[model samples]
Target: MKTGKRYSEAAKLIEKTKTYDLEEAVALVKKTASAKFDETIEAHFRLGVDGRHADQQVRGAVVLPHGTGKTVKVLVFAKGNKVDEALAAGADYAGGDELVPKIQNEGWLDFDVVVATPDMMGVVGRLGRVLGPKGLMPNPKAGTVTMDVTKAINDIKAGKIEYRLDKSNIIHVPIGKASFTEEQLTDNFQTLIDAVVKAKPAAAKGQYIKSLVVASTMGPGVKLNVTKY
Candidate 1:
């Protein structure tokens, strides 16, 4: 994994051994993002809890005040008036059984987030194998599976993002783009941290947030001090 000269230069700006405040880390991340395109700034959380334990699992969603920079394409799994309701609510693609084959056999996956009505779960269940592996499966915990299609669609359109722990117990999520102002990035970053901290499972003992890091798509990781978290 050889980094380009620009990436190497960007890496120089980050101190490998020092932990920074959230704002300072975000500033460095923006400065180090020298890519021609607007780089996505991602926040990586290394949690002390073990993902293997059911009680310790952490998963939820939040709508960023400033919103994630990218546009979100939503696909709703519903039927009857719900399908029409989903479309009217701004779902990019809305339907029932028809979407199953398109995603399974045709491999048609031209959407970012997937939302399904409670009753439509039966149809959505058919694509479990296809969607599960890709993390596209709608879940109640994330508000992707609900009876209120309009609210779901509106929240997603307004920059709602899901955060869940990976197998390593780390949660990786995009806070904003490098083009975002430091204040905006800091606001988004703090909002995400507050949500995660609040969602902490009682089963999770010891240090909850082991490490926090923020980095640009093509830049080196800048560590954030967890003491204040």
Candidate 2:
């Protein structure tokens, strides 16, 4: 069976961690928080009901954080009004009909994400065959198809981490690696947990945040028992 440590373990680790001062603890926390997933993360996205859906179509955004930790060129399909906006918003490459063939080349996937203004979706939609398989296609449900290019670009750059429920409805995200100082990792974990808890949909009742865990690269996982805000 897979028995895991309880939240008390984290509190114990917190108490046992040695620190000369508050500042030192802060610095150490940042340096020590890191974790490595055993498997490859293909798609990272945030999901929630838009309140418009009875079934919760899972609306959110996905960006190749760390730019996929690899180089990904971007293709934008837009015209007239939204063209310049896409570029200024930090899209790697932005254009209209010209972008389709570029995406056709086997190498087009070298880019990470593709964004299209709602107006241009008609044109960009044609490239679905090329972009869909690569997981590079833009979908409105993911918040990629939008007129607010600036917000999209800024969110991608700001370490907009994602969280989603597993078969157990438990959401997970990496706050930091084990090497990070306890304080630094704690802040990251706290920030993400707060956001997720606050994002709870009306359909979710009883315990919204079921549980939380913090682990480090090559370290064991420790659950966190969060109190309601």
| Candidate number with greatest lDDT | 1
Number of clashes found in candidate 1: 0
* 1-229: candidate 1 lDDT, tens digit per residue: 4467788888888889999988789889999988889999999999989889999999999999889999999999988999899999999999988778889999999999999999999989989998998999999999999989999999999989999999999999999999999999999998999999999999999999999999999899999999988
Instruction: Indicate the TM-score of model 2.
Output: 0.57
- In candidate 1, position 31 carries an lDDT of 99
Query: How far is 9's C-alpha from truth in model 1 (Å)?
Result: 0.8
Q: Over 4 Å off in model 2, which ranges?
A: 1-75, 101-107, 124-142, 166-170, 174-184, 227-229
Error of 2 at 74 (Å): 5.2
TM-score of each: 0.98, 0.57
